[model samples]
Target: MKGTISHRDSFLAHIQQQLGKSSSKPASIRRPVWKHRVNWETNEGLSKEELVEQLKVQCQQIHTRVVETTPKEAPSTLRLLMKEYGEGPVMTSSDRRFAQYECHPMFQALQKEGISVTSWNADTSREENIRQAEQAKYAVVFSDYTLAESGTVVLSSHQGQGRALHFLPMMYIVCIEKSTIVPRMIHAASALHRLVEEGEQTKGAIHFISGPSNSADIEMNLVVGVHGPVRAVYVLIDDE
Candidate 1:
C-alpha cells in the first residue's frame, strides 16, 4: 500500500513539473487576425463594368510608366515590348507551316531563338523552380487568380512554383485569365482561406505582386530591382 501511494505521488509530481514547465514557456507566435470584406461588395457604389474600366485605365497608366521609365538606353517601345513578351516564329501544327504571331504563341519562338523555356509541371519541385527563376531572364506563369484593382497576381507558392519564382527574376510575366480577376484583396484572401480549410495543405507564404520592384530610397533617386523584379508584365486574356 505504501509503495502504491509513493508511485502515485511521483506520477502526480511529474505531471505538475510538466505543467509548470509549460506555464513558464513563452506563448507561440500567431498569425495576425484580420477582418476581411469582399472588395467589390464593399465598393457597392461602383458597378462591375465601371470597376473593370477603372482597373484597365489604372493598369494602362502603370504599364506606360514602366515602359517610359526604362532608360531610353533600351530600344524602341514596340521592339522592347515584343522582346519582353516573347520571341518565336508562330507555327500551327494543323496548318503544317510557320507563321508570324506575337504573345503567348510566341513563347515557342522564344525557345527557337535559343532562350530557355521551362514548363512548370503540377508536381515540380520547389527548389528547382527557384534555381531556374534565378537564372532565367523571364518566366511566363499561368496564375490561379488576379486582383484587378491592385494589379496583383495570386500564386499558391506550392509544388513546382515557389514564391521566389514571383520575385527573384529580373522580369516576371504572368498570364491572368480574365475571369479570375477579382476587384480586391479580400476576395483573394477568402479564396485562399477556403482552399486551406479544404485541406489543401498549402505552404505558409502568399505573395501579392502589384508591379515592378523599385525604390526611391537611394538619394531619392528611383532604382529598379531594389528588392524584387525590375519589371512585371501581366497579360490579361479573355475568360473564353
Candidate 2:
C-alpha cells in the first residue's frame, strides 16, 4: 500500500509542503500613501502665464485647441470658435456649468445663429437626451482642474456630468478657470481626494483627460477620436 500514493494523499502532502515553507510572520504589505500625506514639494516658481504657455504648447502637440480668454471675453471667444469650427449640432453639459454658460450672451448668440444648441441634462425623454449628445458635433463641459505639466484636464463625473459629454461628441470643449490650473496631475488628484474625503463634493468618478483620444494600435498608425472626441478644446477662463 505504501509503494504508491493515492491522489488524496498526494494533495495533502503538497499542502503540508506549502505550509512548511510559508512564513509565520504577519504580512507587511505597504499601503499606498494618500496624496494628502505625501511630503514631496513641487516647484512653485512658475507663474500662471508660464504654466498656461506650457500647457498650450503641449495641447497643440496633441491637436487640442487652447483659447485663452477672460470671463468677460469668453463669450466672444466662443462666438469666434463657433464660426471657425462651424456651428455644431451642439449638446452642452447638464452640470452646473450649463447654468454658467447659459448666462453668457454667446448662448443666445448661438441660438440666433440657427445652431442647434441643446442641453444634455434638460428635462426630456432619456433616449432623446442621449441622442442629442450622441449626434452632437460638439459637446461642452467644465473642467475641475487643468494639469499644466501634461496639458490634461480633470473632469468629475456626476449624474449631471456624464461621460457622454466628454467622449461621445465629435468635438469636446472644456471650460476651465485659470485658477484651477495645477502644476501636475498629482496635485490635482490630491485636491480632488481631499474634497471627496471632506464631503465637499460628491462624484462617481474622476477623469484625467489629455488631448483628443488617440491610439496607435492598428498597424501602429496613430488614429485620433476613435474612442473619444476627435478634437478637444480648452477655453481658459482668466477671471474665475
Candidate 3:
C-alpha cells in the first residue's frame, strides 16, 4: 500500500489548529516599539575630545593601550609603538588610508632599516597571505570605526584584508581616526543600517574586537592570547 504525505500548507494548518489560531496571515505586520532607547542615548552629548577620553578609560580596563597623535605625528607614533612591541616580522593591511594619513612612508623607512614588513597583497594566494600573517610578530590595520564605550575597534575585511590578518599575529596594532570614534555600538549599527537602506554595497566580514584575545577558565582565572594576538594597541590619530 502507498502512503500519502501531507502538503506544507496542511502541515502548517495542523500546527495552527493545535495552537488554536487561524491559519490566515495577519493583514499587516508592525514592528514593536522600544520602550527605552538607552543604547542610542548613552554618551550622546559627549564632545569628540570627551569621547576620546572615554575610549582611553575603557581601553585601560581592557588592558589595551591607547596612544593619541596628530596625523603629521602618526608615523613617529607608530614607529614608537613598533619599537615598544619589540622586533618584527611585521604585517599590515594594504589599506589606502596609510598613504592618505601620510604614514605609508614609514613602512618604506622600516624596510630600509632591515625590518621584514609585509602588506596584504590582493594578488597573492590565500595560503601565502595566511602564512605571512602567521609568521608575523605584529599586524597593523586601520579601524573603520572605534566604539568609545567598549574600547572596540571595528574592522571590515575585504580583498586586501583577510580575517586571519587580525587573529594570527602575536601583536595587533590598530590605527583609529578620532573622527571615526562613536559613542557606542549603536551609532555604528545605525550608520551601517543607513548604508544598507541607501543601497550601498557594504559586503565584508565586520569584526568588533574589544581587546587582545582573552578568556577565563571554569575556575575564573583569566588567560590572555589563547585564540588571537596577545597584545593589542590602538593608535588614535587626530585627523580632524
lDDT of each: 0.57, 0.79, 0.91
Off by over 4 Å in 2: 1-40, 95-104, 122-126
What is the lDDT for 167 in model 3? 98
TM-score of each: 0.61, 0.77, 0.86
Off by over 4 Å in 1: 1-40, 44-48, 60-109, 120-128
Q: Model 2 Cα displacement at 104 (Å)?
A: 4.1
When sorted by TM-score, best at the front, the candidate numbers are 3, 2, 1
Better model by TM-score: candidate 1 vs candidate 3: 3
Evaluated against the true structure, the overall lDDT of model 2 is 0.79
lDDT per residue for candidate 2 within 36-131, as digits (tens), equals 633335535688888888888888788888888877676677677767987778777766654554534567677887878887664676678778
Q: Whose TM-score is higher: candidate 1's or candidate 2's?
A: 2
* Model 3 lDDT, residue 187, Cα: 96
lDDT digits (tens) for residues 41-153 of candidate 1? 66545555565565566666454122221222122332355475555221111111111113334455456777666654445565665676677666546567766565667
User: lDDT tens string, model 3, 18-69?
Assistant: 9999999999989778999898889999999999999999999998998888
Which is the leading candidate under TM-score? 3
